[model samples]
Target chain A: MAPQGQVTSVPDDGLTTRQRRNRPLVIVHTGEMKGKSTAAFGLALRGWNQGWPIGVFQFVKSARWKVGEENALRALGEVHERTGQGAPVDWFKMGSGWSWTQRGPLDDHAAAAAEGWERIKADLAAQTYGLLVLDEFTYVIEWGWVDVEDVVATLAARPGFQHVVITGRRAHPRLVAAADLVVEMTKVKHPMDAGQKGQRGIEW
Target chain B: MAPQGQVTSVPDDGLTTRQRRNRPLVIVHTGEMKGKSTAAFGLALRGWNQGWPIGVFQFVKSARWKVGEENALRALGEVHERTGQGAPVDWFKMGSGWSWTQRGPLDDHAAAAAEGWERIKADLAAQTYGLLVLDEFTYVIEWGWVDVEDVVATLAARPGFQHVVITGRRAHPRLVAAADLVVEMTKVKHPMDAGQKGQRGIEW
Candidate 1:
């Protein structure tokens, strides 16, 4: 029923245009104590299964010892074993310069944290991974330790194939505008206020 | 040099104690689009202002549409206008669902659309919302329409002080999980892929 010179053949099997062009950048806004880090861990595990290289960046106020980050790393190990993707890369923790235990001016400590953010920026610029997770990086901006504009620029400049996931509370409107996906984890209730201290395997 | 046994009476802030005692329930997940109804909208906005009468339940497929909810509702003046509250009451969305126009079975439509999750759960219980925002309720649970235990339980058993949010993607999960808030919307993506088209403002 086609014209004499018209080509009426369908494209080859197992390939589609949408799949070829679908590259996503996800932003997750985890409100206070709603397990944003845990969700990131789940995504990392899934990415590892697909043989995607991943980078983890933790930028928070006074990062000393967070059990959630540790659990995420341990989960990465399990993912590695399941997928045979070799060992997972260790996370880079960019602290707020001053230790939580020591309460002082912390000018020098703040400088170190700034340097760590630079390192993260550089890694993102280099485009070294299929997925990158920026954990609690929003707090750095909130505390005036990092420039939100610079972060936005870096994300905008990323290569098309790279997928970036940023997590934190109180994300800026600018960041939300730049993101392809955003999830805000609002906390309705928490157990800590009811005379219950942070419990292992739950709060951590 | 204070006098012995001089009792410094502390003013009892009743808000904190009440908040702790009530302990609002929160449910977070991904579901179909455009499933949450006006009831969910009213509760989320009103309960947030009152304090301690809030819950966030999202049932969307991917974590993409949350920003859309914020923008649309805020533009429509649904969200509370003031500040200084300990935490804001707002509905959050999560997840990406399948494209409707794709060449799939029509049987997947209801599940993909999340038809019944929002109303059945949120409205039936009637107690879950001081405020509720069901971000995406339909599409997430479209595959299994008949089996929705969690939805029933949550709707049937939620506490009086709780507000609910229900977004639509697939309602199967939502139906089993119960919702005090429900929303549903048609989806239209950017740049308009072949066989896909969208109007300005409506799609965005």
Candidate 2:
């Protein structure tokens, strides 16, 4: 496959690999297909393996979703704590519940989204993690819970060598514009498209 | 955050979650975007946590490119072999080198691809792994070395409840049609677009 080059008004700076590694980046993953969060989680796993502090902040995922990547990452954290080799990690779910009846039980998705965004902002300010995954965060912009400009500004001005990864579909134009790296997942075929339901262990 | 149901004509089977767990799956990650192999590695890690045997077949990755995930997974494999916990893993890079100067270095990319496919087929027939990741397999099909139809048929009939994940770009249509799941990554921005090459422990 061939990905088109970066598109938009703000262009990426011509930084060498060493300089680039030292610079913080805002990476975005938005798409209509699966793997956005999965890919982001993969990146987090890579970062953790490199001994970088990692943080995963889920904005709108169902609280009960309990993804397999989450379990694996948490296990990695435990392994690190037990043996001083893995990266320190943290995972947070600010979204509501899963289940057919209790889907997003929160009365105000907007408020919850705002709260999630605010906390992430604080983390960015403190540069608490070298690699921070804002899992499913595009939902906040998609649902109008957070302003795109604020996100772009915050990410643009974030301190330290922190690398932030945002994941979800329908990322705002401004967010895409501000990102240093962006990936849009396009679906070609999926099991559910064939009437298959999500499976455990693999799905969660 | 949420994947809308499948949109293609291939409807997923009405397999119960338990049944799905018991059935083998053929998943593909293809596109121009980054993370195709990364996501596949993450899945392997999750499966390893569940004590499933994992195998990674690298078809066309540069011989010198030893990804961080490989290191991490191999370490996990070592841990398992010593303590009898995590899943056993085997990593193979069959297809020759990368670079215009040393492309394949084997005179015949097609023959090398075929040989690689043949070995994987033997492994599948032997049910050598529960979670087999055919990393960069699409390159073989893309290069017309192996028949997509044959590849698809082999996976469709593979033995055991083994899950196979093929990752690369430009997946063939027949391959996509035969896949249980497919993700096409679209690049919005890349570090290389900014003249920043892949960094050690990050891109590799």
Candidate 3:
């Protein structure tokens, strides 16, 4: 019941509009020792270039000197430099160097580390970051240092504006299910089995 | 103290020897929107060629026809054709069809269309994939259909050998905390806001 040239359309019920505005939660699961950290660093660099505040966390308890982590942090620093944001110090590096827990009980050490992690988490939550990487966060849960439920509850309650990333080997299944997206990494080949040590800058 | 020249020599500890056996997880979080889905597709394609099993999941309740998913599935089909590994019908034309919660009371029609997500999740956790992608999963949570905790738990419990990726905007902090890498997509300049309708094969 309209003119020949009239374009008939449905009324604008706010449904579609609301859906369009709803943002989602994204989670990437990179498997163990598969350069997931490096890829994460690349994403962080991209986010920083766009002027987003960023934070990085490591949860592995092994306390070994990881070249990959070092390199990722270094790259982030360089990205910041290029963007004229004064170099962001590598807090992990500056902190008490990796403390290998190969000996006796790690009760005290883990407790202290958990405190540090909480502080970092607080800073991350307070800032308006576009991207925040919790490298090896699964280890915190895996090691039973932090309560997984508490972590999940806190994250779920956050504002929709911030993005966070948790990474580590043996991530909790609950964490994966709760995420908006999940990715796993598999390894098919490597050069280290050939009796070669990790090359300085390249491997790191 | 022993003689300087005869000092007990330390073993290499085999850290380097075992390096080859360790496969690191490589996760690439491009962002929530924009080109992330395509970037993930490219990475999955590369991994699939190496004989890696790739899992794809779309969390957005509403399924719009997407050429990217179609093209990626086609590429996968080609791989199956060459490898004689019967093409997985699920790979090609994969999607959930429509938002899980589209206003109005839950109708039988909508419930019927929402079942595909479960199948997709099952495939991801089946342990057959080298890389798994959960696309637009953020919407699932945003729409309040899937419990974020369940998703996170499932993903975390996945075997250590698989690489996983979750993509969408406004990801939960818990998922980010559990992820090895997280990338947030900030909309700097998008053509859609300029009154450009999505183009087939390009925007999809």
Best by DockQ: 2
Which scores greater on DockQ, model 1 or model 2? 2
The 10 consecutive residues of candidate 2 chain A with the worst lDDT sum are A95-104
- Per-residue lDDT of model 1, residues B1-204, tens digit only: 557876455337444544544444443333222212322332332333344334444443442333433432332222223333313443332223233224443354455445335543544376534545554444444445434565566555765555444444344534533432222222222223333343221132
Ranking by lDDT: 2, 3, 1
Q: How high is each candidate's TM-score? A: 0.47, 0.80, 0.43
The C-alpha stretches of model 3 lying farther than 4 A from their native spots are A1-26, A61-107, B1-204
lDDT of 3 by residue, A76-153 (tens): 454355445423524242134323333444456567557656765565567545566677778777778787787777
State how far residue B32 of model 1 sits from its true place (Å).
Answer: 6.4
Per-structure clash totals for the candidates:
69, 7, 60
Between prediction 2 and prediction 3, the one with superior lDDT is 2
lDDT of 1 by residue, A1-204 (tens): 999976587567454545434444545544554445555644554444345566777666442344444443444444455555424544655443323224444356456557766776666677667667777777777877778788789778765456676777777777777765555444333445445453322233
Docking quality of model 3: it rates as incorrect
lDDT of 2 by residue, B122-177 (tens): 98999888899888888788888899888988988886678999998888888888
* Model 2: residues with Cα > 4 Å off, grouped in runs: A1-17, A20-22, A61-66, A95-109, B1-17, B20-22, B61-66, B78-86, B95-115, B144-149
Provide the overall lDDT of each model, using Cα atoms, as 2-decimal numbers: 0.48, 0.76, 0.51
List chain A TM-scores, every candidate, in order. Answer: 0.74, 0.82, 0.69
